[model samples]
Target: MGLLDSLEGMAASAMTNSGSDQAKVAGGLMQALQEHPEGVQAILNGFQNNGMAGHVEQWASGALQTATPEQVQTGLGGTGLIEATAEKAGVSPQMAQTILATVMPMVISHFAPNGQAPEQSQFSGLAGQLLQKFL
Candidate 1:
């Protein structure tokens, strides 16, 4: 299998194992990217450089905690992120619960150097930008 293919299988397992909608999470990630495209890009780059599933899990859990069921379904469900998630290592929706089952303590401990949520926004401006750029 090629890279995307490998990513697809991993996403299948990750989503099945994760028990949540990949669309929602991916959408949320997009939203986050929209809000702070540069910051989100930087974070993704950091994750890539670190190549650590644990770190991805921590960040994903934090991002998903207060997320609603609608957010879960629309963002993660059937968005092909099931395959993409393996690339990130964090699970979605219910899988997030599974992935974080024993990781609560660790998630609480991580702090941004600036001590703030970088992608924090009520709306995803970067997502719009992405759509505009792609469309």
Candidate 2:
């Protein structure tokens, strides 16, 4: 399995052993990250590698809090992804956020139920497609 799928599998196991709200959120967040291949790949070997579960256990499971809505928006707003999208599509930041907001839910759902992660091929296609949508 790919890093993405492996992360989701770990998250699925984490969910079964969830001990707190934070743990659940972390588990879900991990799944979501895995499902979003681009995001996961960005940090695949960065920090959330073979030790992701430990990071979650040490931080997210307790001290690691999930990001707020503002944080999520700000993160997307600050990323090169937004500018690239806007430039390609010739749309404003506001429009970009609107599109991202709509797509965010789908990304979440992609990791739903069993916390299944998406395929890298799918993610590659999606990442390019999402960027293209703005273009």
Candidate 3:
């Protein structure tokens, strides 16, 4: 399968395996990533800047680690990602932060299947697909 197909499949699988709330958070995250000029890189940068480099490294190594809501806030706070996600998902910011603690790891794992972060170019089409599938 192609890269887009793989991303789409991963997103579809995530929605199928998760609760409705999680699906909404995932869609919201996708939308947020799409809107960000830096795309997935922004997420990586946010985590790294917030002293969550270890977590990002773990995810890039193909491990799924849980992040706390506070970690999410610290990492993504100023980026408007969390707020945008909450708005798009129709959830409170706190709820979005909680769910994103799970969804973010899954997203990183999907993009880092080979134990490395994906190129920004690779994610250019993913948000639209995820939004279509889950939103």
Residues forming the 10-long window of minimal summed lDDT in candidate 3: 126-135
Q: lDDT per prediction? A: 0.35, 0.41, 0.72
TM-score of each predicted structure versus truth: 0.24, 0.35, 0.74
Compute the lDDT for candidate 2: 0.41
Candidate 1 segments exceeding 4 Å error:
1-20, 37-40, 48-135
Q: Candidate 2: where is the Cα deviation over 4 Å?
A: 1-72, 111-119, 124-135
- Higher-scoring candidate on lDDT, 2 or 3: 3
lDDT of 2 by residue, 63-84 (tens): 4344333433554543345444
Q: Residue 86 of candidate 1: its Cα lDDT? A: 30
lDDT by residue (tens digit), candidate 3, 44-65 = 7888888887887787776777
**Which prediction has the highest lDDT against the true structure?**
3
- Whole-model lDDT, candidate 3? 0.72
Model 2: which ten-residue window has the lowest total lDDT?
108-117
Per residue, candidate 1 scores C-alpha lDDT tens digits across 53-114 of 34445445564243333433333334333234333444444653333222222222232322
Superposition TM-score, candidate 2 onto the true structure? 0.35
